[model samples]
Target: MPPGGRQVLGADLGVVDHAACAGEEPELFFHGDPGAIALAKRICGRCPVREACLARSIANDERYGVFGGLTADERQELQGRRAAA
Candidate 1:
């Protein structure tokens, strides 16, 4: 996938889209501080593929960075909810 998670055409199938973060600087998502996490979440909040991104992160068990506008703690909570259901 290209940087910034832009959609790409599959060689013999439908269009494939990447996460919005793919286009952004890697540091923006990986910064290990509260302010950086907040900024990254703000960016993700406006992403068109926020749901997909979050779902992918959760399914993949991502251990760091922001995805789908949520922090690691938030994702963990969500995972808990999913397990409860």
Candidate 2:
């Protein structure tokens, strides 16, 4: 069983489960206010699978919402860094 009550295939194949934000409202991550972004980052900072979440978001080119404590712009910057490396 994967996170968020969903059974993802290859759970035993090194797939990282992401359930830390399952119970959080979607608005918390997508809001434009800095306070909301900070709250979302705080929640993400405590997540065990934060790295995996960010990796996935980056790989998928996520254009909105906060993932792994980073906003879209942050992720874009990270992508740029990765590309530059």
Candidate 3:
């Protein structure tokens, strides 16, 4: 059993190119596409470790695609609100 309903880190890995993520100019998770983001949110909705995953992404400053079903901007916005509080 894994934390994210999968047995691996990159399991069910979507189309977001990791190379682009690792590169200097990272691609935005969800590609700034609302439909894709909605799909991602649906996936995240069922994740067992959703909170842990989201927290990890925020803490690590993940600059790439969605994590715990949240887009990069959503995560950043959440992080900002958390910091403000």
Candidate 4:
């Protein structure tokens, strides 16, 4: 995927306009490879709807792919921090 896995969420594609990851290889977003994950995150770093993408991932508890420049574990840590705060 380009970054935040645009096409994978065809349903939410319309929700987050101009997804940066659009048309990219979806597998890149879900890859177990660290390098691929980093590439996806880099793609997400340039995305306009990054916060929105992250919000959606957090809201849905998405646990399998990169979103909003964060890996699943990162998202969990973010949520933990938010909860603690």
Best by TM-score: 4
Lowest summed lDDT window (length 10), candidate 3: 17-26
The CA lDDT of each predicted structure is 0.72, 0.77, 0.60, 0.84
- Give a tens-digit lDDT track for model 4, residues 1-85: 4554434443455656588888689899999998999899999999988887888788778998999999999999999999999
Candidate 1: tens digits of C-alpha lDDT, residues 3-66: 4344323231121154456577888888888898888988887777787677766766777888
Residue runs of model 4 more than 4 Å from their true location after superposition: 1-17
What tens-digit string does per-residue lDDT give for candidate 3 at 1-85?
3342433354333432332233332233446677766666676676565665666676567777788777777788888898899
Better of 3 and 4 by TM-score: 4
Q: Encode model 2's per-residue lDDT on 14-50: one tens digit a residue.
A: 4344447777897999999999999999999987778
Q: Which stretches of candidate 1 lie over 4 Å from their true place?
A: 1-22
Q: What lDDT does candidate 4 reach at residue 63?
A: 93
User: What order do candidates take by TM-score, descending?
Assistant: 4, 2, 1, 3
RMSD to true structure for each model, in Å = 5.7, 5.0, 9.5, 6.0
Question: What TM-score, to 2 decimals, does candidate 4 have?
Answer: 0.81
Q: Would you list the clashing residue pairs of candidate 1?
A: 3-22, 3-23, 4-22, 4-23
Tell me the spans in candidate 2 whose CA falls farther than 4 Å from its real position. 1-18
Q: What is the Cα root-mean-square deviation between model 3 and the actual structure?
A: 9.5
Tell me model 3's lDDT, rounded to 2 decimals.
Answer: 0.60
Q: With candidate 3 superimposed using the best TM-score fit, by how many Å does residue 24's alpha carbon deviate from the native? A: 26
